[model samples]
Target: MDSALAVRALDESTWAAFAELVEANNGVWGGCWCVGFHVKLGKGRTAAQNRAEKEQRVRDGETHAALVFDGDRCLGWCQFGSPDELPEIKSRRLYEKGLTTLPDWRITCFFTGKGLRGRGVADAALGGAIAEISRLGGGVVEGYPEETDDRKVSGSFLHTGPMAAFEKHGFTRTRPISPHRWVVTRTVA
Candidate 1:
């Protein structure tokens, strides 16, 4: 992999690259297209439907993500948006149970290209997402990442990313949403 990866905001101009990455990753977890956290789940939409809707959302400016690219190839992404923009999330039952205030933005998922894990792509995607958030008017940001310390969680199940990824990016644990899932919060100025 090239060490000179650049981060780009997912938008109309960058949609193709984003699509390519998703398609290459088997629609990102059973053809999810990373839409599982963006809308109500169990909708029974096919991969094709998910792709179409995701593209429409991008055109409508209803979705958000930071795409990492190695030249023209998208290596991965970190999906983030307003709570309303990303209403669904992991451990929702417990997440809202202790919710006091909703974050200005929520990082719902991450995806790295095949054989690209451990190459800092996700970390870069996270930083890129925060930078994009700041550019879009900085505000309170939050994410749910698993506490992977001392545990060997498969990368496939780490769509929410790892706790270390958030902590190093300045997010702090606000509360534990589940046994392994923690709500991390940080304010971007």
Candidate 2:
């Protein structure tokens, strides 16, 4: 809620914060790190393998998203990278129609701690991701958000942030990849 809250690129110091943010809020995916989709769908690595590789990537400063912080604490997580940066997303059916060479930034994942949910943490992260991408230079931003009919909270939901939430952040439906999946986009102009 504080406009002074800042979103900074994922860094080593913030790595623990990012992990803490997820573990404190959503334990299932948080426990494994944001490597589930990337590992299973992209690299086909075991969970332990994925964990080690992700850790190495962070150590190597190859992070592709920004961590949301309120003062010194990390409160949320968002993943952004050029489509090419995430080979797993391209291998998935949901992104089949999205052009790979367009130099687009894809928001493939997000997580907010339980106490921070419904408090606009995700909106701030999305805004921060867009700004980060735009700051680097205007590029198409894509996100696949889940279509939820009733705004009910579910503990099982992870990956693919809420469609309405993305819409609220200025993302529009670019395509309906499935009954519950929609590809949303916001072109920086």
Candidate 3:
């Protein structure tokens, strides 16, 4: 069997697939719709309200993420955008230390479905995300993959992805901001 991957912008036509990926793997990130790190964090807003706000971002062409697909099926997702584009990240307790606002594109989170875990889906998504950002005219792409001594960390908190996973895709940790988070970045050349 062949596995051809396609990465695209999150738009109206792709909304359902995006929603399906979140719903099908609620345990992965609690049916987040991938907005917790972009809209819900520290906002004190209900999930529904956060979802609504995030949906408006997509509609307003202000989305900072992309969904990954294996052919016609949505299998993974990556959240990337300018720091200013993501309110949740900016509002986090570690925001100042975890992120650097230097006109860079940030990859704050990633989620691949249960059946697709450990299958290089995240790597493919990362590559595709790089290409997406590069095609839009090259900028620094940053990630904050969680580092754990135990490999058994659950996907819910592993949304940042594994540090090894990011390293495999050319991301290098510039600094360690916390015990669980490290700031990683790749400057497109």
Candidate 4:
């Protein structure tokens, strides 16, 4: 056995590990439950609701993510889904301004354990995501990654991960959806 982080689909079987990671991280981004991209969290949206709905989606196979695990403990996850499955995104106005075609899969967000920051967890989660996408019938995959080259970006805002991380995994820049965020794409086959 390679004592390496393995990627597993965010299904019912792995829901416990995923939930544990989320719980440890304050439900992730103010109790988002990693569902911000799937559903808009307006005012009054409680964390409990997010968790419940997220679990339902997982059971229904409506949610998709690659959960990264070291041994049996989940360390992080890379969320990816169809455009319709993950419609709500950052920079929506800019992201949709020049939209022509939708990628088969959208890499929405990534969350790592609190103690594992600045490590290779994000990269591993992304690699896991691409591999999972390939296993699900490869096609055009897109990610909205922030370019962290010139300035110091707080890790708290890197839910979508960084550009260089995606680049090493074969994703190329398609366009700039925001000042520092680039719409990166790759054909995973």
Candidate 5:
């Protein structure tokens, strides 16, 4: 971890910083505002609409994220929420097919700054999420990370994070959801 890295929960006061980071990254996967997995997929929504929805969700305290910062600059974030809060997953059908128990929290997405990729920012965000969840009360924290050991992968496809990172944090692979994605989890204490 970077000694200068700091992590904070996303709240009203920190919303601006989060927004700035997303905007700098070209609205994050085409103006997603990090809400693609939070809500149902809808068509004909513009980037502005998505931004407005995300802002409202933040104001309403409906969104959860571990925001990573380097001094005054927002570098990255890890998104998490309850199953009800984030009902949709990338491979929903496959994940649900093997679902037996619901997790207390789910890590849905991760993002680092454009030029700051592979700089341990995502690790800081993951640690922050675990710490925040533990502070709230420890429970089973789930994550969906891609297993890309055999071939090289791009940073964009690794938005959910690499499986090795989750494993380093003591998250065990529960099941394989897709060809390269697996459901990994850890009990925060």
Candidate 6:
């Protein structure tokens, strides 16, 4: 971790920094605004609309994310919320195939700046999210991270994050969700 790294929750004061980071990355997964898991997918929405929706959620205090910062620059973030807050999983059927229960919170996605990819930004963000969740009230938090063997995976495809990062933060793998992804969890205390 960078010595200057700091983490903060997404709120009005930090919304601009978050927005700038997303905008720089071409709106984050084709102008997603990190809303793909929050709402239904494929609603034929434009990038601007997605941005508006995300901004509204932040303004309404209906979203949660741990934004990582290096001084004034926003490096990345980890998106997390209650199960109801983020219900749209990409592999829904597979994710629920053998599921018996839902977690108190889900760490759905992570994003690091374009130029800062391999600098432990996502790891720091994950740690921050865990700490924030713990402060709110300890509970079982779940995450879906990609499991890469000796194969190469694109950075965009690893948005959920890499399995190793989660494990490094004390998350344990529960089961496989997809061919290259696994359901991992950690009980914050």
Candidate 4 is scored at a TM of: 0.96
lDDT of 2 by residue, 1-189 (tens): 567678887767777776666556544353556765455534444445555666687888655676778888887867887755655552267557654544367888887766676666777888888888888786788887888877665734646688877888788897777777777888875
The residue-by-residue lDDT of candidate 6 on 9-43, one tens digit each, is 99999999999999999999888999998987586
* Clash-forming residue pairs, model 6: none
Query: What is the C-alpha lDDT profile of model 5 across 92-189, one tens digit per residue?
Result: 89999999999999999999989987668999999999998899798999999999987999887888988988999999999999999999999998
In model 2, residue pairs whose N, Cα or C atoms come closer than 3 Å (at least 3 residues apart or on different chains), thus clashing, are 25-113, 25-114
What are the lDDT figures for the candidates, one per model?
0.90, 0.70, 0.72, 0.90, 0.91, 0.91
Cα RMSD (angstroms) for every candidate in the order listed: 1.3, 3.2, 2.9, 1.7, 1.0, 0.9
| Residue 95 lDDT (model 4) | 88
Candidate 1, residue 109: Cα displacement in angstroms equals 0.4
**How many residue pairs clash (N, CA or C atoms closer than 3 angstroms) in each of the candidate models, in the order given?**
0, 2, 0, 0, 0, 0
Write candidate 4's Cα lDDT for 6-122 as tens digits: 878999999999999999889998899999999999999999999999999999999999888888999998999999999999998998997899999999999888887665788
Deviation in angstroms for 85 in model 4?
Answer: 0.6
Model 3 agreement with the true structure over 34-68: per-residue lDDT tens digits: 67666545545555665676678788878856678
Question: In model 2, what is the error at residue 156, expressed in angstroms?
Answer: 3.6
Instruction: Give the per-residue Cα lDDT of candidate 3 at 176.
Output: 74
For model 1, how does the per-residue alpha-carbon lDDT over 104-152 read when each residue is reduced to its tens digit?
A: 9999999998888777899999999999999999899999998987888
Residue 70 of model 4: what lDDT? 88
Instruction: Report how far off residue 130 is in candidate 1 (Å).
Output: 0.6
Output the lDDT of residue 160, model 4.
94
